[model samples]
Target: MGGTGGVALAGGGAWVGSTVAAQPAAAAAEAAIGGLTTPPAYAPSGRRPKYRRATWSQQFQTSHGWNAGGTGTASANANDTSVFVRGTQSVRVTTNGTGKQSYVRRTGMTAQNMTGKMIRLVFRVDDVANLSKLVFYMGSGSLANYFSWTFHAHSTTAANYVQSGEWVTVHLQWADVTSAAGTYSISAAGSPSTKTGFTDMSFAVYDNAGGPVTYRLQAVELVPDTATVFPKGVVSITFDDSHKSIHDLARPVMDSYGYSGTVYNIADAIGTGSFLTVGQMRSMQDFSGWEMAGHSYANATHTASYPKLTAEQADDDFRKLREWLVGNGFSSEHFAYPHGAFQKTSDGVPVDLIASRHFTTARSIISETIESFAPAMPYRLKALTGINDGSGIGGTALSKVTGAGGRLDRCVNSGDWLILCLHKVVEGTPATSTEIGKAGLTALMKAIDDRGIPVLTVEEAMASYT
Candidate 1:
């Protein structure tokens, strides 16, 4: 589960073998999260730049089997220096019979302490005989962890992680290695850097087999902690089919706690007794943090009659509903396919323009946790239905609120959105209502407030993704 033995070089260039103990945990765990009182502010430094400037490069020589290649470069800072070596001009060696090695240089760097700062390294590989044992060395001549994907491979092996003939970006965060906080971890991006120490950085090309192999070096960069960007967690809630009970029973509880929710409105079903009327939807849209999104013009069942509806029919229905919402003073940027039914064109493109104009994010029954997928993926919201009846809302709602099975508790801990979809909040009867009465709803709201997770409407959540 851990890396093979390696070495670490202290600030004065003293080397230590891989027997060093792990550092203590950082203080971040003890710090309190202030609160989710407001949307996080965007500091100018957090923004990603449109284009990056090359800083350094190192190309590998073919002595170990690789052909000669040139290394290019880029960086976000001008004062930050790095090194470069290309295959055509440098020495190459072979590790065993299979891997290749190359010569590297350190230029434009000054020795300085980099104790708390975050450092990043990127490498580019044109080709590789095998990628099993790639490693990196700092200015102190200590080898960092081998560049393998054993821990992050999901289900694959580390040896199979190489992408030959294409640029691969690897990022290495020094903060995680140096601190107890686990704040830093190494990752790769497109190219390798030539920077060294704290003042200037440099990069070198080497093969796992200690022999030479040919490959191109694009660029390398050493970005400070302030220059790195991290994404904020996203939370989204959706209510299927604007059921009147959502407004009559759920609305009051949500509004009282200032919780926001998205109501998926079925155009033709609006006036039905069990469903919300068009007028009710328009009013909900006017409320703060509440949003009205399309579920379909008539709850079209794509699984049954998908091919029957022409492209124009589907487009027209979507367009009309969007126009109705916008003309009635609602945000027109969200929509959910009715019953999660959708169509794909002959070329695999969605027939409806919902994917084009308005819908920024779409939700499917993907997973229970938002962390399960990439943050950029459309959030997968889970429905808390009768599956957990024995222990879910069926148990004491207060116990459920503070316990593991509680929806709100899971959402807060995982930083994923909790979207509660309720049908008929019955006046009586445990079977129909799960017996989660108004008191239960109140208790749930209090738990959410105490946990410090902001409750925003679906529109608010979608805005963050777009």
Candidate 2:
């Protein structure tokens, strides 16, 4: 079996139940094969092997690979293709204009017990507003037992209503389809027919809002478990307060070590004093890469009674922020509560609105109090220690977040997601009263790089969890 959404559906499958801790791919394999609940396996101490064998890396560079079916028309889309990055041919699907305007796409495959294999599929949706929902499934040729999930390409429309498709490249990391889908309810335990086992792939889309939608399937292949299994101690170094110093000082330091960062901006504060200018934000993206999330619309800095914002007020705050972000070539998919404080009023406002509706994540001001270490369910509620001004007075030291070296060392060694939160990246002034000094920040970045772990922006790292 192969695998792996939000309403606005997770390109990543939905988190059905309890969120598990970060475990490596190998450990994930052992646990899935054995039982639903089991302790993690021995994590690797050093580097993972680079070599990989594709049980079958079917490069759909040409047509006529497998049988294509459905009410839609599947044709080789050399016109709209990813020739450079992903071979030549991309299969384009255009469904009929029915009420529940959708399509069916299935291709027969050789029968094999794909129980614990890490199944991977790749595709993209065009810039069409009518594109409502797309789902992929795996099952026996007869469509007896199957599993399905939704994916949205954050793309925009004619009126510039952007929806998860600035040309989204969906790399669905469906780990061990068995565990992902759940215990196979109906199975052919002893059957040996060619299509007896789950031996076919089906792709379908449901009721488009507008007319008909055309989505492109670049290619879909099954990856070895050793390839894309397990979670690592990923580092999402997020800097709050759109401080100018972040773009001026911090970016260079992080780039020097091949690292990137996320900024929780006060939409109303850009181009203002000591705040990030629009040009600098774009430059960081061009120079290296960056992520921008909502901090607050106007009130990035907290007032005296910070923790007590009403739910309606909080919604209004985030809404303004989202508007600014969307209007500025960005999607308001992430948010960081101002003052690093999480607020959920009993009337069901503020944090609740941010959590359920507004943002995908609500990062924590306090690192230790955070549930687990990294990539937890209320993932929006991440734990972060400071690197610069995040002194032990309030949040954990930058050193603590970096495991102070050994602990940081072991954190990566054992494969946990470590998110280091910082404010400013300053130089001379020991403004221990505020931001992190350049020296300490430099050292922390170095230690993190030495571990050979991937440094991702907050949005990028979230993909690993599901």
Candidate 3:
């Protein structure tokens, strides 16, 4: 009555559509004789040896060209034994002006079962123009019918692969595959770097004759049913002044990739000519994951009012700004000192009266990691510069926290909040850059996420402290 392997017996008359006839006498006797055996014993609840789930993943490194037998031809290379399992057919490669081919088969060796799996491919290239292609085949097809993922600019023009050259890593993820067609995703980076979002993707490689082609190839890894969680950590990216570019250009990009930042608004600066409007500030406050804090009224000149104003005068200024913020539907809990300057008494209590009442916490400019500074008051930490600048944290900047035991590393080790203060997000600005951009900030956030710290806005972080 069931499909496929259904059992049927001879009927006395014509057989009915849904019914099965009785078994013969000899068949019934054999079944009854085999029913008295004991079942096998098996362990129920004991621990088995733990093996890495990643062992089934595959990795390949190729230096020599795909040419086999020292004869330059596009044919199967027996000596060159680089193989890919399913969804991959022939390896059509061109290296140093010469073309060659190799075949991937599951013979004698164990082939990786990557059905419905997440995989990553990292490719390292020597030059940018040297083209390398990886052909993927789903059904029984020749190189003309398969999809070719190619990488263009490569450094080497010879048979031997160069090590210290520009390389790219390609990531491929496979989903469902059917008789009709299969689905997959791919991403490529200049080096062996992992990214959250991918672009330049051509899905469903339907061309059949070398479908979608990418440039370079380094290494490929398969992550089978594994969950990659971003580590938890606290990273504070603060931008002083109502810099709309930080919000308009940087914020969207940050949010697009799941990151949050704090924008410190100088109360008097908003709605002024070159600054963000009050409406923009309010919009940022209502932004799903962003926070707006105070950057002081008019970014008060340090040379004029500071180091001279009595505690009372400072308190009045603070109260005026704090009341304005609250009236404007903004939180007055977090404040950043103008010019990174704050008046302090002999005992180190901030002399500004508003420091005691209006603000929950304050921050100042103290670049690099200094263990002696207190985290509770006037949180002194490095401020990020614009991207590519030698001053911003991350990247090739030695002044920033790119090296070992840098500011970010120290902050992680101490489990302290690392607040990065910035004046502007525009280029050609002091303590900032024009071309160097928020990508550095993104990198820093990723680093913090990697180190297992929780990133919170100024207001959110202040709430925890309180």
Candidate 4:
């Protein structure tokens, strides 16, 4: 139910007893690997590092000397104590309506080697509608020599959509680089990799919606890519909104591949328009072994405005939703934010302060990266972009779905959990952007199987973390 819907999310493989008389061959293979009651553990490949520490960080304190791009304006104020995630002040960037690339840039620094490094940025948008792509740039002092990596903070097609006026953290990995020029990617001359160092940095939010827009930056850090490869990675297929098409279409396909998924259902919407009925969910749960999870209350909007609610209100909303799930004989151990919107409460308490008290694991559609085995924030697990017509293996044929640029390879090579978000599954052409054709779903499952990766439910994947 998020905006980004192109890539995978979390999980590999888990087992479920099917009511179908003809058990899938994949099921037997999965059972042989102990996928029946428990997820199989793969030994770490030890080809990559296991720890990550900040190599460089910025707090926007003092005279940071950041400048705006093109016709935009940018400044840092020591006394601007309005919103600060780290310190007492933050950098404020205002875009001019004329600039296509509105950004804040700072140069004149000693070159820092960023090979195999990831960039982290914490920021907030005054109006999400005015923001296009969230881009990060690294340069070798010369403006012409740089690499740009884009994050999905505002992309409507991406799974992880950061809400307006809410603090969001984005991790831009090396592979996220969309464009590079000059010495950014040296021609096979670097020792470890062809990637070069950077002496300049820029944070950008595109102004695609016209008019001047404002955003704030709290912190930025350069960290090592502590992701590692395992003997086999895991994939968790997840469906949001309890769309009836998922049960009528996706479930049978996944069952054929010996995979059961986690369903985040809106409690109040059960048996409502286009939603799965409780009886249908029961069939999937008891017969297909699907895990029923919480989405939100029935009358809640597609996206939750948690930051607008007081801490007490947020807690009540979350509690009622969980209670609805449990009261209906569903597991309330996990939850997905409605439309992937989560942030601090209106009273300034972090959303996790309230969410952690209700659910064991909280998943957010934020990061495009795979969730680590031991996630840094259990309550805010990163999910890849949604698997939809535009972003994921949806609407495409099997070959294109398992193309050379598939995201599943990253999981297979990194031993991390990839949580894939899906909304609707249709047998014919998709009528909406949220729907993926049956062929696309089948292709994705086959791709995961071809790589010999296991699929697990969210619960199974979290439990297999050890």
Top TM-score hit: 4
Rate residue 130 of model 2 by lDDT: 62
Q: State each model's C-alpha RMSD to the native.
A: 17.2, 18.8, 26.3, 13.8
Clashes of each: 68, 28, 39, 30
Q: Estimate each model's TM-score.
A: 0.46, 0.48, 0.43, 0.65
Weakest ten-residue segment in model 2 by summed lDDT: 1-10
Error (Å) of candidate 3 at residue 133 is 59
Tens-digit lDDT track for model 2 on 162-280?
Answer: 12222232322222122124333422221112212656566566435456566555455554442233243466788887899888788889888888888888877798878998788
**lDDT ranking from best candidate downward:** 4, 2, 3, 1
Error of 3 at 402 (Å): 3.9
lDDT of each: 0.39, 0.50, 0.40, 0.63
Off by over 4 Å in 1: 1-235, 301-312, 342-348, 351-354, 371-374, 379-402, 405-407, 419-424, 429-440
Deviation of model 1 at 295, angstroms: 1.1
Question: Alpha carbon lDDT of residue 13, candidate 3?
Answer: 7
lDDT of 1: 0.39
The candidate, 1 or 4, that scores higher on TM-score is 4
Error of 1 at 364 (Å): 1.7
Model 2 stretches astray by more than 4 angstroms: 1-232, 304-307, 346-350, 369-374, 389-395, 402-407
lDDT of 4 by residue, 1-466 (tens): 1111111112211111222112454443333222222221221121222224568888677776676555454433433555554556776777765547767778877778765456767676766666666788788655678877666545654333455554565666543455677655522211223455577888877777466677777667776543433345577888888899888999999989888999988877789888899999999998988999887764554455566677667767777777777777875478787756665566654565355556767788766455655454565677654455444434333343256545565555434567777789988766655678798788788889998888888877666543
